[model samples]
Target: MSVMIILIIVSLFVASGFLVAFIWAVKSGQFDDASTPSYRMLWDDATTQKKINKQSSNHKQKSNGN
Candidate 1:
């Protein structure tokens, strides 16, 4: 059908747009630190963990008062 032809053209345009955006991101160093993010989660500093625990406990106490 004629509609199928138009749909295929539109889909191709959309796919090409995504490809261009991905290429731009690569050139812009958006993915340069690829491995650091994966390792970041494993390096949990103790001070930040203590602060998070303190905040959560405070939040729980405040919520319980309601």
Candidate 2:
């Protein structure tokens, strides 16, 4: 049927679009750091808190001196 042929063409276009997007992601280094993300969450909180504390202490010191 003509409807079936149209459906096949539409499906092929959708499949090719997905393939192009996947290839672009591979070329763009999207998957290059796969392992880092799993480990980052474990250490990010501690490092972020340390940075915040350091900045706050520096601000307090400058305010007290003035």
Candidate 3:
């Protein structure tokens, strides 16, 4: 019974620490550029088929010892 109380207190303290850290991160601008990541993900054009084809050709040359 007493161990349960100690466990609850420790759990609450750990949870509070996490909450404080998250709040500190928010205040420190960690989540400032929310839209940038989303837009960057969508705007990235480097994944086009042309680039992949070139990479594949390079790998093929390496495999052929050329």
Candidate 4:
């Protein structure tokens, strides 16, 4: 039937849209770090905090000198 043909065409278009979206996501690095993010929460941030504190202290010393 004509209705069936139309439905098939619409379904194909929808499927193709999803495929294109998936391809675009892959090409744009959407899945580049699948493993890192899962373990990111377990990583220690103490070093980062130390660096930030040191920078702030240096800034304060400069301001006091000026």
Q: Mind giving the per-residue lDDT tens digits that candidate 1 earns over 16-55?
A: 9999999999999999998998877766666679889999
The per-candidate count of clashes, in order, stands at 0, 0, 0, 0
lDDT of 2 by residue, 25-53 (tens): 99999989889888899799889999999
Per-prediction TM-score? 0.65, 0.68, 0.61, 0.58
Tens digit per residue, CA lDDT, model 3, 1-66: 999999999999999999999999999999998889877765566556668889999999999995
lDDT of 3 at 26: 100
Residues 1-66, model 4: lDDT tens digits: 999999999999999999999999999999998999767765547667888999999999999999
Question: How does residue 37 of candidate 3 score in lDDT?
Answer: 85
Q: Compared to the true structure, candidate 4 yields what TM-score? A: 0.58
Give me candidate 2's TM-score against the actual structure.
0.68
**Whole-model lDDT, model 1:** 0.93
CA lDDT of 64 in candidate 2? 100
Considering only N, C-alpha and C atoms within 3 Å, which residue pairs clash in candidate 1?
Answer: none
Pairs that collide in candidate 2 are: none
Q: How big is the positional error of residue 7 in model 4, measured in Å on the Cα after superposition? A: 0.9
**For model 4, what is the C-alpha lDDT against the true structure?**
0.91
lDDT score of model 2? 0.96
Query: Candidate 2 — which residues are off by over 4 angstroms?
Result: 49-66
